[model samples]
Target: MRKLQQRLDKIKDNNQAADALAGRRSEVKPESASPVAPERSRGRRRGWLIVLGMVVFGFVFGELALTVQGWSGPDFSDARRVGKATVVSCERRGPIGWGIGYWDQCTADVVWDGGFSGRYAIDRRNFFHADEVGTTVTIGEGAGSRGGGVVFSRPELPHRPAVVALGWGLAVIASIPILLLLGGTFVAARDAIRGVSKR
Candidate 1:
């Protein structure tokens, strides 16, 4: 009987040991199989998103700044006549890498009546009137024609509505990409922040 009792006690201890080991394995498994890999991948994607957003913003909007500056100049409507000049050459200038057809710029080089010469830039309003080489155009100087930048003018200013509407439509269409890029970047950043807080 004593021998049987000893055997029973040994079996009980073995069962208890097995139970303890199983509990420990359950705890360890949760830790080892934790969902950490996906979190790391998400972090990497968010980092890339922010970086790409900034680069695209700088590249696209920076070019817009330059384009606006180039298109603007002093008003010569009230200026006195400096001299008459002959159109030497015709060329076009605009922002590079994007918005090619949306924005228009036409420039001409002219030789002044007094044996002097300089390049003249015209805005979109006068782009259609870009003169041919050797054509005569008037030059107007700012501040009563005393000393300032010159402006070029043509004899006739024709009104064309179709070209103006086309330019406006193209400009509106070009803005879509910029809006989408910025919106996507903002959403990605917000999601990343929310994920971090949850953790």
Candidate 2:
């Protein structure tokens, strides 16, 4: 009978030790589950969201500006034809990822009215013209010019009008994400305000 009572006491002691350990663990859980952790997590997510929205906004806005410029081109109304120039080199650098050509560059040797002579780079958003070396290309100057003045092709190279349309379409499509992000931010802000008012 004494041995049986001792056995019962041993079992009770083991259970109490287990209960105390579990109590310690339970006490530790509240600190681990701090409300600040969730707030920090939300802050990080909001920061990332804001960064993404800015990137999208900048990209779309830049593309829109470029599209407008490409369609309208430069103000050539005041430009005048200079003279014939010998094609030194011609290159088309563009069409990154898929087939979107960027710009056309043409180098030519020409002399200005002021007796200035040198090779000039005719860089513009113009269609690629396969001009061979030694080819005679018509060149021109803009209205106000100085110091390696504004030189361009007499008949500006042709650009794909479809590209402007494509750019507009892509911009509109990309804007959907911006709108969603903005809307989400607005809703989140509204909810936070309401939560603060309630508190």
Candidate 3:
């Protein structure tokens, strides 16, 4: 009977040790080990974030491309020809990601006095006051080959090549914070996943 009681005591001691260990583990484990949201919710959130990052990156890349073009484009005095340009056609293109928020692409063809013609693409909002087929607009002079010698009729929007380049240079500064935020989120998510895996 004594041996049986001792055996029961040992069993009880083992259970007590296990319970204490479980309590310690609960205290030591961090809530962050798991995702902040459910796995499904996290995946959705990450998908949205990736899309946001990609869209923003595309804009930034385009801006920088324009900036570089402006920087490398030739002086305005060498314009091959300058005069009234008749708009042949204008196309509005948009609808991204399941056709949501498609307010971005516009391109028009302008034929100048010398029969010189070129395509002008404008991503900015309302680049031309009255850009449409058969519209008469003045050809922008001094635009290097980068701009395809095309310029918007709206003067304020098209700055000097140097100024355009400088503006983009400065604009890139603002993207730093956004990039950091994206990077941090990615790192946090990765770490959370890693932590879960370690368990």
Candidate 4:
């Protein structure tokens, strides 16, 4: 009887061990056997998202660069009569960048032939002629045939090449960050989609 009982206990122990092994195998089968391909696919998809983001960033940078480059110009307005004289000046009311400058026109009545005459005058004593392009005009204290030359105003032909170049450079630099963000978002979205599909 003792031997038989011992044999029964051994059989029970063997059954329990077998059951534990079976449970472990079942748990591992679904987790470790499959889904490797899906994981790899997800990684590749993430990489593609990064690439797409880079392209978008490049486009944005290029656009910004073009916009900045287009801003290199003198703000000018058509000739208009202020008081009694016609004046034409560059109307720049904002900050001037490296390659930008402001020009203004101020005019007043002048005595000509003992009669009031309308004349056009630039903001400063510097007489800016249409023919004088790419030239700097310095306005100083002086009165001319027109009314008092526009008080203290000057025209400067700033170095535009550097400004344009810098703008382009900055645009290019900004593209990198934009690309990174876009790529990250795309990859994340793609992964999410894939996960949903798998589910």
Candidate 5:
């Protein structure tokens, strides 16, 4: 009976020691259940900050693309041409006009007399004389020598709506990344704030 009593006493002492150790551990750190919450919130905030930085970079890139694609200013002054007659060798005249076959059209200021001057289109088709003013100049569009002169007519260029549309499309596409980044940042910030508030 004495031996049985001693065994029971030993068991009780062991259980008491285990309970005391558990109590000490609990008191040492009371917030062990949710220690990772603040860390997760901070990580989310950092992610949002990174996204905002990326958005700013995307906006700058988009602006640069727009500036590059837009027209800077009007065409140069050499685009205008004025002279007395084709026989006078207007090619030697200062600031006469952009040369023939150039992309831009040249307008000739033909001076017949001291006071008689008229504007004419100088292109591959029509060579204007002083007397040709006020007369209808017909430009040919067919092949061969018959059609290869600049008549008094406006030059036609290919339609460029497709190019304009393509430029706009590219600009919008480049902006999409910025938009998404902003949205993601907003969502992350909101979530982080809510998490902090809940804590």
Candidate 6:
């Protein structure tokens, strides 16, 4: 009888321990789940933020590079100026590389009809979306136009430095958000790891 009683007591003790364990697990599971849902939400938002940042970075960087190059393209200031040419044809074509949107290459009528027959070419961005077919385009005799430090993009504005300070300005503006995103990601990850460890 004593042996049987001892066996019953042992069984009772085991049951109590199991119940306690189940209780603890049930309590912990809810708390862990709550935190996890929020973390996953944050992770999703951060992923999208990173994607958007990359797109913006690529666009701004390309424009910045193109603008700078436009400002510094071959100098035609010393051009042998075969003669002034009137824009005969203007066609919009996709950018070959590092170019932003629409680009136009114009074939100008070099004053060959009057003297020597020849053709000249000049290209510019379609900023105002204006028709330049009738516009007079300067044909460079040699290769570049370097007399002026900047080409007057705007007839009214006069001179614009190659890679206008604006490009740097946009880059600086774009960087602030990206830097914040990176720092936020790092901090969030650290905090998340720390939080998990505590659990």
Q: Pick the candidate with the highest lDDT.
A: 2
Regions more than 4 Å wrong, model 1: 1-32, 77-81, 91-95, 98-109, 118-134, 140-199
Clashing residue pairs found in predicted model 5: 82-109, 124-150, 125-149, 125-150, 126-149, 126-150
The TM-score of predicted model 6 comes to 0.49
**Per-model TM values vs. the true structure:** 0.43, 0.49, 0.36, 0.33, 0.39, 0.49
Query: What value does the lDDT take at residue 26 in candidate 4?
Result: 79
Model 6 residue 68 CA deviation in Å? 5.3
Give me candidate 4's TM-score against the actual structure. Answer: 0.33
Ranking by TM-score: 2, 6, 1, 5, 3, 4
lDDT of 4 by residue, 1-199 (tens): 9999999999999999999999888788665688898899999999888777777666666655655654442222211221222233333321243223333334433323334454445433123433343333333222322653333222332225666787779686857777677677899899999999999
Q: Number of backbone collisions per candidate, in order?
A: 0, 0, 2, 2, 6, 9
Model 5 residue 154 CA deviation in Å: 14
lDDT per prediction? Answer: 0.57, 0.63, 0.58, 0.52, 0.49, 0.60
After superposition, the stretches of candidate 4 with alpha carbons farther than 4 Å from their true spots are 4-8, 16-40, 70-166, 174-199
Cα lDDT tens digits for candidate 1, 1-199 = 9999999999999999999999988788754688898889999999888767756665565455433333333354544445555555555544365332244344556565556766765554333334455666565544523555444433343223454455445455546656767797799899999999999
lDDT of 5 by residue, 1-199 (tens): 9999999999999999999999987887646766788889999999878777777666655654444333221122222332243322223221222222212224554554334666545533223333444444322222322445332312222224454465566578668887887687799899999999999
- Tens-place lDDT per residue, model 3, 33-108, is 7656588798989988876876577566555544444323234345556655454544553433312233334555
Error of 1 at 136 (Å): 3.1
Q: In model 1, what are the clashing residue pairs, if there are any? A: none
For candidate 5, the C-alpha RMSD (Å) to the true structure equals 14.8
Worst 10 residues of 3 by lDDT: 95-104
Candidate 5 wrong stretches, greater than 4 Å: 31-34, 72-176, 179-199
lDDT by residue (tens digit), candidate 6, 75-189 = 4453444355676776676654545656667666666324775554556554222376777644444432444432213332223554566556656665666677778789999
Ranking by lDDT: 2, 6, 3, 1, 4, 5
